[model samples]
Target: MTQQVPDKLVIAISSRALFDLDESHHIYETDGLAAYCAHQRAHESVPLAPGVAFPLVQKLLALNTPDPQRPRVEVILVSRNSADTGLRIFNSIRHSGLDIVRAAFTGGASSQRYLAAFGAHLFLSADAGDVRAAIDAGYAAATILPSSGQGEGAGGQLRIAFDGDAVLFSDVSERIYKQRGLAAFAANELAEAGTPLPGGPFKEFLAALHRIQADFPQDAAPLRTALITARSAPSHERAIRTLRAWNINIDEALFLGGMPKGPFLKAFGADIFFDDQQGHCDSARVHVATGHVPYGVANEAPASLPFSVVSQ
Candidate 1:
């Protein structure tokens, strides 16, 4: 008799994201999605980039033992294709015996657009904004890296860094910092020092991670997280107090005020860094993995850098 688990895990995936193989591996004569699905059904393992979807999924499933009380792991597949395609993929999911709860066809122009709105406990896709939205919505998300099909860099832990203002903490402080500049932002944070700042996009995921850590206290995996922001000294003080108040454990935090983050991120070995400023992402990407977050005060928007902001 399997021990029943009371709660269920909801994972929202794109029909294509679940495919077994890297569709772009061989020359494709058919449409990308169709060829991709065909390859998966043929048992051709797709080459997922390091620190990407398949690795994360594999890790999660490994954690899922038979919990008689907990509902079976459920995967919700979303796609922008016709119902026929969705059904075909759904059938494939069923045949594979993967824990699939449902399938939805969003029929949007881009699959990324649809996946962002398909809320689940986790979202896997390459869209930066969609990934940001999913994180904002309290879902764990990972982007499919284009290169290095498998395995993380040797010895180094997979490092993920988040910007404080909009990506990790509420944009309220960020907007103040942007509109009236740093001095005003510091004053406001000092005022709200005792009060908890509203959680930002990554709050839910951070909480989930804490829960996971609590469950598996002995096994501290190589996953590390950090907060890199441009708020130094007095300003950084309140943010620190806020996180402490929330009981979120961030492995590393840098209070860089008006300093380029690329070098610091390089030092931290950040696999990926998320920030609302295009310039920050631009500079950071040269030395480390970087993503541009598109939210918060419109005026504080960092100028577009030479790097690609959107994930392919």
Candidate 2:
């Protein structure tokens, strides 16, 4: 069935990303697997509360239908929980009325291996290790951070926002900026403004989203996307050029030029924002659900680098 739906925009999400399982996770960490299983079994019938990515999942699933030919979205649950303990998650799914029918209950093993089989365009999880594995395996994956913000945009749209460098485009420019400072970075951008930047980890995912968007009338599309990057002026030109070359449409573009992204993302009513920098993710999550994309040069050898450099 999954093979039959190859054209669908499939998203693989972890159970913890879908539900508030903090207490249960803590129990597993402390009392071992048996206790965790016992607790889950004891509370199997009680529906779990929504987690950080819950609202986004809701919106994405709302765009789907039983028809496979038309543009549609499919959400597949990929969890480390064994099917026995995972009954609670399934119960919660039914309780929440999510139309999720495909899943992989991998016991305690990593679920990244199943992502390719399911043809997941994107994967979201709370585990940084799992996210990294998925990224290494070439899927658009992010560690969904805990957040306290409105789940949906005002118009009930799936307003997804992404960072430019490292997240969407390769960190080639970011590495230059980091090593040689802004002056050189600006010079490089000016010199190579015409060249399209290399595709980063999330490029394919963004393109898949664009494909889904192409199915609907422009003004009446069910989903929207924005590029919320720190680049400004000259650097912005290359990003614009790159998106044009890729033929993907980002509904909004905000070149904050290194300003903190919290207020802007809040204003945009972003349901979720993705950035490779932890500091930006930290700031954005205060106002919107944020995902930390731990990829590219920025994430390499982080300890040796200064806090300012890492956060910037």
User: lDDT winner among the candidates?
Assistant: 2
In order of appearance, the predictions have TM-scores of 0.63, 0.95
lDDT of residue 158 for candidate 2: 82
Of the candidates shown, which would achieve the greatest TM-score relative to the real structure? 2
Model 1: C-alpha RMSD to truth?
A: 6.8
**Per-model lDDT:** 0.58, 0.90
Per-residue lDDT over 29-127 for candidate 2, one digit per residue giving the tens place of the 0 to 100 score: 999999999999999999999998999998888776434455388899999999999999999999999988889999989999998888889999999
Off by over 4 Å in 2: 1-3, 65-71, 303-311
Candidate 1 on 176-286: residue-level lDDT in tens? 655566667778877777777787666665665555444444345445678888888777777888789888778778988779987887777665666766777667767
TM-score of 2: 0.95
